[model samples]
Target: MPWSDHAIWWHVYPLGFLGAEPAALPPDSAPRHRLPVLADWLDHLVGLGCNGLALGPVFASETHGYDTVDHFRVDPRLGTEDDLVRLVEEARSRGVHVLLDGVFNHVGRSFAPFADVVRHGSASSYADWFVPEGDDFRTFEGHGHLVALDHASPAVVDHVTDVMDHWLARGVSGWRLDAAYAVPQAFWRTVSDRVRARHPEAWLCGEVIHGDYTSYVTEGGLDSVTQYELWKAIWSSLNDVNPHELAWSLTRHSALLDVFAPQTFVGNHDVTRIASRLREPRHLAHALTVLFTVGGVPSVYAGDERGRQGVKEERVGGDDAIRPAFPDSPSGLGPEGLDVQRLHQTLIGVRRRHPWLVRARPRPHTVDDTVLAYTLHDPDSGAAVAVALNYGGEAATATVPAAAWEPAAGDATPAAGDGSVSLPPYGWCVATAPTLPS
Candidate 1:
């Protein structure tokens, strides 16, 4: 039942491999200029039981791999198509899938089309490829160096489709469109339409940070987006243990359930490490519980289980604290990688065992007490799971419908009252039981 609920949002930093980063470049910056250890990284991802891995831009970008120069070629540093193909092949045999970052909103200044526009002053054949107002082309995020493409134009349309077509055939699962807030929704609809027509199983998840993701799920646009506003608020409030702050995320996200599945996640490369939230082992356990039992796939950022909270800011500046070299062992990881790895395996395995989690619908519930519980059901499997978390030092109890999961579970203790149960300190427990399909 909760299996449908688990997903780990993986945020990777190229600096972990390049061993160098440019100050302020975003996490997932392509190591193209300083190619990282491709085989090694892929191997690590496979070991983690990742069903789907969302990769950042791997094209030749000037900084952070966001300033993409070419949409067609895989950056040389990341390796050739064969390496990618090989990685995909290896992962498939192991049951893992891959997603690449598609930063189409902007391109590097040195991009051929942009270069033409710069040299020809709009008279060039590629002149109209970018956004134009009178005589000037619009820049992305106000960086004068990047040129935003005019997605409505015919030639640009053809070029983008061609590139997307190539990637779909390359054995990748889908794309994570960057800065989708800026890109025209119409273009995305066309992109998604064409992509789905070619590969029906290909799922496109866009980056929609502040608003409703459903508005963007149009023709060729996207299947889903990073539902950040709600989660970010929840993350902040929950971090402070402020009861009043907790309801906002649940209520707001609950409202949007009809539109898209919450791409439920905890930490990414951009934020402070998840360990920062794990003040106690139970705190970390609770976060992982929500991460896995919520109605979505749980994403895992590298080095999180090892208790990585980042290290001293390095030269290639970023949230350098987050980009610390992923420790090989927990010693390499301050918490050590080995211990973290074990924790992840246990949690991820639970998610994998219950396919319903990857497939269920969840209902959120909160009470006067200091705990939050959600009910998830898989219509196809008739399995129901309830996950509860008590953030307080002492134990807390919650009442559930008679229809909630039954206590065939060894972890569940009998309630002091009629049938309700109390969960242990800083603890989260998952109860999965069979039911008849509605």
Candidate 2:
């Protein structure tokens, strides 16, 4: 399985696309006010080799799309449903999939359906749509004015299923379930089976973070979960060049043991900016290299490709500054900009061309505090790729095993073998080794 064989999901957020707003917005307000200038912008993503764009409930007539006011219709403010339809069509034509954020976990307080239910005070037929916890299903402590919906209700179940199925029929590739863990695993299992039944080849990833990914994956509720902590660990190690710490941190992802695939990223709406965390361009490059060439799908956040470093978090004074408009090629620079333009383009090709990257395992021989070496082998296909990372502040060395570098006569790869690999300070190597199954 090449990387394309597995889904390397990416994202295009509405809040980030359009600048963040004040604390709130009216139901009739316009969000993502920048969609009109987004064609060439979006086209650039595909051009840079992103396979998909995880767009939102652009139905968010508000700041961030997470506060979805309407699930059935696209936000007229973002663009018309026809605009979205065209986006899907255009992206598909370029081999890009469009996955919308399904936010059934919650709805905006302004949502008409839920509002009527509140207004009618139980007399409304749609009252069962939300979690009936006294009079305040949409608010608590007077913050995050979101109406948590009831997934257990038949009406809600049917409604969500219908919504996903509708998009599937309209050629949407899949969905990114929001705050998936907050919803019961049983509900996800039900929705998963239903959606896959409708589109057997469809992809579904949960927003479950690293803390509970092992449990999440074991339950068979999501094909993959966001690798939040994993990305963070990798980011910290690469920036600091702490191979020992990186290796130690990666140990938490039990997915590394069993056959598992999850999404990896350095930053998103809720996390620290990757550039801010790891300032070295090469360090970031090294982390991203593992992200792509390692097992599982590698997700590139909007501004990650460019080295979007600025103030730290809001405390560090960099809350909303990183989410700037997609910068154009500088003079002769490529569309994704200079910082990571070539690296991303090149790695995307490498991932697309290699099977070991998609289906192989990250078989690290060891990470002895300074040197990190690993081999990826497609046990089923016998293809392999070896990786060596030097996390020491100074240079280090390693050697590849002969058995891992040559394929057996009748197999696609060679049998297991070992050798010491070499490396330089904070440097890494990505190369396919020949190998056989036996």
Best by lDDT: 2
Model 2, backbone clash pairs (residues 3+ apart or across chains), number: 11
Worst 10 residues of 1 by lDDT: 1-10
C-alpha lDDT (0 to 100) for residue 173 of candidate 2: 83
lDDT of 2 at 322: 54
**Residue 349, candidate 1: C-alpha displacement in angstroms:** 2.5
Candidate 2: where is the Cα deviation over 4 Å? Answer: 1-4, 18-36, 132-135, 138-142, 214-220, 248-259, 310-319, 327-339, 403-422, 436-438
Angstrom error of the Cα, residue 262, model 2: value is 1.0
Off by over 4 Å in 1: 1-11, 18-36, 41-47, 132-136, 243-248, 277-281, 311-316, 327-339, 364-366, 402-417, 436-438
The number of clashing residue pairs in each candidate reads 35, 11
**How do the residues 1-438 of candidate 2 rate in per-residue lDDT, one tens digit apiece?**
332355655566655555445334555666443454445555667666777787755664444566677777776556566677787887787778888888878877777878798789679998888866654674422445777888788787787788888888888888888888777777877877787787887777788763567666557456777777778778777766567766665555444436567777777656666777776655766676677777667777776666665444645225456555443322223544474766777667667767446544565665776666666676755667666766655766655555545321111222245455445556666666556335
